[model samples]
Target: MAPAQSGAVLGLSLSLLLGACRIQAVKLSSDNLTPTVMEFQSVELSCIIKSTKTPNPRIEWKKIRNDETTYVYFDDEVTGAFENRADLLNRASLMIKNATRTDTATYRCEVVAKSDEKTIDEIKIVLTVQVKPVVPRCIVPKSVPVGSAAALYCDEKEGFPNPTYRWYWNSEPLPEESKSHPKYVNSSFKVDPKSGTLTFTSVVKADTGVYYCIATNQAGSAKCEGHSMEVYDLNIAAIVGGVIVVVLILALIIMGLCFAYRKGYFANSKPSTSYKTPAKPDCVNYLRTEDEGDFRHKSSFVI
Candidate 1:
């Protein structure tokens, strides 16, 4: 090739390189896409601008939760609930202090570089703030009859990720299956950790003890106050005797009623034998006879 042609090719190549350098695209990324932190702790959401020509890019942060989006950082300032507790780190990443359960959501870092070929870029990071469980409410029966079924319950609503449950009897942790442990061999019970329910198929006197429950999560654990339960024996013989006595009394009353009916005690009385006189007739016939022509008359009453 001629020297002039080579110089022309070199100029074209330099121009193409300069154009490529001027049109650098804006790209966003993060070291950690998903971060988990405990409640009331500090967390850093790392957002990095990989490539951009614009020196002063407009940065904004948005939070999405339950299909609702809200601004966390806008107009170069933290807004809303994060006004005082959040700040921008390295002009791109987000720094949050005293993170709470409500802060657990998907956070987006958006950058707008008008001078770049790709004017916008965004990165989404999921933040999870785990909350510790609060004290659980426990229900234990104070007294249960032996050979009867009994149920105990424990529950709490404040924990994140839904805490699992553990039961204790007399300050000793109870196994998930009573039959699996030799200590609880005499007790026929089952425990449900997710639902916090302890059920006994047939309670015995050995099952009587103080019971408590603990709720645990990734963050921490909390327990409920202990409650006492007592299992007592049922008096089957006494119950049977009472039932028999009641039946005997009912039978005696029925027999007395039948005897009274047979002896005529409740029969209707006969009417008195006093006589009633017959009423007199309402009409009578009269007769009169003339004896002679001397004007003498005789009268007689017809019966």
Candidate 2:
């Protein structure tokens, strides 16, 4: 009985060890990685080796970002498109030099040891790259008179790959027509992808609505809403505004008068509590003829 029990316990212990070996040592720092495109940018991917043992024999890095094809694997020492751009930073980390928008994808690390033959340990990491772009918003005088031109200035901030610019009037896109106006750049609207600045010339009343500044590059596209504009027609607007004010004032006065009359007559009046003496029935017949004549006269007065 003792020997049989010992064999069963040994079998159970081996099963548990096998389970541990099946588990991989590599673990990535994050799962969802997003990055933008640009030049001279560096992105780092990190992983942790779960095993206590050092001098990890075979550490491998691979790019598995695309759906169709798998990229470089460190074990093969063969870099596909990544080539020299991919580097294994020790056994626990990988770095991509000069990361561009195209280099963004899912990465994986695999660690293989001699202790467990034909058994492999592995993990996955994700890399994100972000390329900023030039965006513009309009800024100008607070108010403009009707039929007079308004000046609109646009300025762009930090962006990657030096985003290109496009101007929009309302939601409708604007064509690249070169015309001369007086605002910023010449009428054609100057755009410097490097500086990310867009300037508008003399803006007309037709341009007095919402404007959109669109920025795009190989990394991605982004847009921002510009300042709203309203070209005022002083004459017609002033007349309409005055009429609205007068109507509101008159309506308030009429409502106030009706409310005061109702409060005085209906709410403030008190009901009579004293009783009156009953009329004598003996006078009923005598007063009948008199009452009929009085009623006829009252009807004539009402008519």
Residue 300, model 2: lDDT of 27
* Displacement of the residue 159 alpha carbon in candidate 1, Å: 1.1
What TM-score would each prediction reach against the true structure?
0.74, 0.38
Residue-wise C-alpha lDDT for candidate 1, range 182-209, written one tens digit per residue: 9899999999999999999999999999
- Residue 52, model 1: lDDT of 87
lDDT of 2 by residue, 1-303 (tens): 699999999999999996776543332343324433345577666655555333455767777665744646556574787788866664556667887756667777776665544445666666656666544554545566665544455455555445676666667655544343434233334444444444444444554666666777666677776656665656988899999999999999999989988878546557679888987454233224743652223322433
Task: Give the number of the best model, judged by TM-score.
Answer: 1
Point out the worst 10-residue segment of candidate 2 by lDDT.
Answer: 294-303
User: How much lDDT does candidate 1 score?
Assistant: 0.93
lDDT on C-alpha atoms for all candidate structures: 0.93, 0.59
